[model samples]
Target chain A: MIDWIESVLHITVQMGTLYLLASLGEIYAERSGILNLGLEGMMIMGAALSFIFTLAYGHFAAIIISIAAGILMSLVLAVMAIHMRLNQVVAGLAITMLGLGLSGFLAFPDIRKNILLSLNPALPEQALMTQEAPKLPEISIPLLSNIPIIGRAFFHHNVLVYVSYIAALVMWFILFKTRIGLSLRSVGEDPATADSLGVNVFLVRYLATVISGGFAGLAGAYLFIGFHPFWQEGMTAGKGFIALALVILSTWNPLRAVLGAYLFGGIDTVQYRLQLFGLGAQSPYFLAMLPYLITIITLILISFENLRKRIGVPKSLGIPYSREQD
Target chain B: MSRKINTPFGVIRIERRAAYPRHIAVLTTLLAVLLAFLAVAIILVLIGIDFTAAFTLIVESFTKPELMLNSVKQAIPICLSALGLGIAFKMNFWNIGAEGQIYVGMIASTGVVLLHAYYGLFDEHVLLPLMFLTSFALGGLWCLLPAFLKAKMNVNEILTTLMLNYVAILLVDYLIHGPWRDPGGYGFPLSIKFPDYAKLLFLFGDTAYTGLLMAILGAAAAYLIMDHSKLGFEIKVVGQNLNVARYSGIDVSKVIMFGAFIAGGLAGIGGLSIVSGIIGRLRPRASPGYGYTAIIVAALAGLNPWLIVLASIFFGGLLTAGDVLQASMNIPKTVIQMMQAIIFLFILMGEVFKRYRIVFEGKSGGDMP
Candidate 1:
């Protein structure tokens, strides 16, 4: 019983950490009035790039290169929507299609092989079964980890989990408290007015997209290196879209986004637990779809007028700004 | 960039502007699409495939009569769905749930097929129409939710429709894998092969010529509706300007709902044709993402039904060519998708050029005319 409890907790922490990082990045982009529907493709691209790079180089270098690639791709979106003044939604969709096709083309041949053997040549044959995932070093504070339930949940986690929490807090602080945050909000709210105030609306939007891309890349890296430690085709599996929905459900608040991600994570974790507890064979697929069902429900609920008025979205979200038009 | 004069009422006046040459845009889009194909060709050449032989294989695949018939057989669903979407786009209603509606229609048609096979209530003649009606009803019903949400609640229909695609996909996957799995099939995740009573008749010997005929008929019907009906006028008015439509007492919501219903119903019929004519058994990945591809077809054809037929045939030929390239040239099937994306991007860019003109003026001079 104790071992089962420990394993469930471990799974929850891993899933929650991955989702929290990705949703936080989505929060930043949506708050800036840009809906990056290409998140799924971006995450997949990041995962593939990180996986290949980590196999060739080490962990740190792979993470850096993946982040750079993600930012570079996001720049294309920024150019089409901001400079060319194309429709944001369609442009985002086009980018997603391009990313998916490119990644599939690149990863098709190598995906069929056992990638782990190329990465770690020193492991024994039996170790392959047990070490399906490479263990990340956990950081347990000497005194804090010994407390009660809260201590085990919060203090005893890997470096990536800790970084996700810190990153969420930093995002909340920067979005709510800083001058740049104010400018970003203003640009999202009314780019014409923001530009009239000499706020450089285009530049702010470009920077926000690039930063969001970097965070999303890190999210993908976490999926590869921390959660499963394996690569699969089309593996990001709609998590990026869920993150986009979570941004709306959280009312574009980064802090609320963290809470929302963990809540979804908990639901997903419980569904898996239910399956493990001798449910029928088909239960897992249904269980896996729970988070997506909740997201759709949440979207419908938020579309209610009173609810939306209470937690307002940015007024001018997804509308491309044209300087000449104003 | 040019001017023409016309005498409509015996008065010749200089028409300072004419519509941008659509043929040029189409040619440019085709050129861009071919350039993307050429890039794949270069890639194949570098990978040690004989590029010329591969190109010949693709070209020959399109020229054969049987292959051309097969291409049209496949293009039917895409053309039907694109026709429906073209109507909705004309009214500025972005109904992206044609995919889900297609699945719903398939589910409905399959239900009818099972009923007829088990109960023996209707002859084959009656059964076919009943199956088509059932599919159309289910497809329209599936679309109604997103349409209702958009018209009544101002929800973004794009996201809602998109989300519904996954739900429909999962629902179909669940059914086929569980309750609907054919007992006699030895555990394969599929339904029973639909009986002859449920199948669509062939127009010629051993070909899905009836399906092709239905697609052509659908295109004609859509053309008549958009060009010669009062409802079409209302749709056009609403698309051009909503306030103007409202001011004219056109009931914009009703128009939108009507367009959506018909569009969705047509797509549902398309799905029915696929199962009844081509595949014969329900499977999880029944569509090779044809519903989404219809979006490109609709846009490429400029929302005209006749042009949509042409565009669908063109795209369907491309799909066949891509398959040939995959087998003969060692090229990935994703190259076709990449080319489609490139074409869509260039078309969108062409639209920008159509709507706005770029002017350059000297720093110290007045604006150039």
Candidate 2:
């Protein structure tokens, strides 16, 4: 029973990191009043780029290149939503479609051949997409790893997992405890006022969005190298959207995001363990539906006007910021 | 109102337009499409594919009669789905769940077929209409919760509708893989094939006459509601300004609910057309993002029902072209999707031109037009 509990908790933390990293960045973006609906696109692109680069170069190069790819993709959104002042919703959707299509196009066997051929020329071309990379090494902390079930579940993991823990803490601190965080929050809440106070609304929004893209990229890389380590088409499969929901559930708080992501991760992990609990007869499809269904339910629960107000939902989210209009 | 920017040699002014001529908007859209095609060609060239050969194949897809007919068949569902989305978007409701609604429609219509297959209850004459009504109702109901939440609680319809889409898809997957699995043939995840009585009547070898007629009728009905009805005016008013709508005594909630229902029902009909008319029965991965593609179609058409027909056929041809490109050149069909996205982005950018005019003035005071 103890062993079962530890493993479940272990899988939960492992899976939760995907949401944790993605949502943390989104929290920053939303805190700066930009609703980027293209996280999925960025994430998937990150995964595809990382997988290819991993095959070509090493893991470090793959991670950096993926982050660059994500930043590049988000730049499209920043230009549209922040610079061009297009409707953020439509622009985000366009970015998503672009990412989805571009990633898929780049992942094609022939396209991969030409790409890898150009990159190295000496590497094997056959079975490129199916090729695996060296997984991120797991480092267990000596004293922490020996504590209890929680120790192994929490402390013993890959470097990215630990990076997520530090990332969340640092993000939470940067968002609430610093002047930069104040400027970001103020910009999201009221860009006009923030601009009046000499905050560079455009610059802050651009950075936040790019950072969000970077985290989404890291999440995607973690999804490939840290979690599944495979290149199946459409594998990310709405996980990006789930991370979006986690942003709201966390109420734009990076600290709260930790709990929300893990909770969702627990829900996801529980689907696999349903069989172990003598509920093996339940269809895996229905179990798969839980996270999405719960997201809707969460949206409904938090949608009460009073709750939204009290929770301090960013006021200018999804609205374009224009200095000329101001 | 205008905003002026000082460049090194001149002053550039961007002035808001009260209105632009219709022809200019049309021209801009056409230019955007041309540019999108050109952009795709460039991408293909960079990847070492022969752009001219690929372009020739795509043009051939449009010229061939049978392929044209297939494009028309593809147009029907896209047309229906876009029409439904047009209604919702007009009311400023982002019901992106048409994909899910399509799945539910398939499920409901397939349920009717399963019932008939098991109990032999309904005759051939009643079967099609029965499937039609059930699918519409279920599809409408699928969107109702999000609509209700958006209306009453002010929830984000985009997220709710999107989430439901996955739920509806998973529900279909469960049904096909579990209860509705075809018991006779193989272990494949598929429902039983529809009988002759359950299948839609086709005019050509593969194309459905009913689907075309339904799309036409659906557009006509949508046109009547949008242009002639009081509800249409209410929807327009509500979308333009909620405060104005409320001040003018429009039942905002009722209008939103009604519009969402119609929108969902139309997408549901699109789903039915795909399942009953195209494929024979329900299956997993039935929709190839028809719901999402409809968003582009509706937006391209400027939410005009009549224009949606033209846009759908145009996009449907592109989809066919994508299949051809995939088969002949070993290119992924998502290349077409990339083209569509670029087109959408360009069109979105073009909206700036429609709304604002840029005038260049030289510092020397000689370049004003």
Chain A TM-score per model, please list them: 0.87, 0.94
| Top lDDT hit | 2
User: Candidate 1, DockQ to 2 decimals?
Assistant: 0.33
Instruction: Show where candidate 2 strays beyond 4 Å.
Output: A125-131, A275-281, B202-208, B364-369
* List of clashing residue pairs for candidate 2: none
lDDT of 1 by residue, B144-201 (tens): 7777777777777777777776777777777788878888889998888888767876
lDDT of 1 at B179: 78
- DockQ, all models: 0.33, 0.72
Interface root mean square deviation per prediction: 4.1, 1.4
How do the residues A92-117 of candidate 1 rate in per-residue lDDT, one tens digit apiece? 76666666666665555522123335
Query: Top model by TM-score, which number?
Result: 2
User: lDDT by residue for model 2 over A250-290, one digit each (tens)?
Assistant: 89999999999999899889887885675754466787777
Cα deviation in Å at residue A80, candidate 1?
1.8
How do all models score by TM-score? 0.88, 0.96
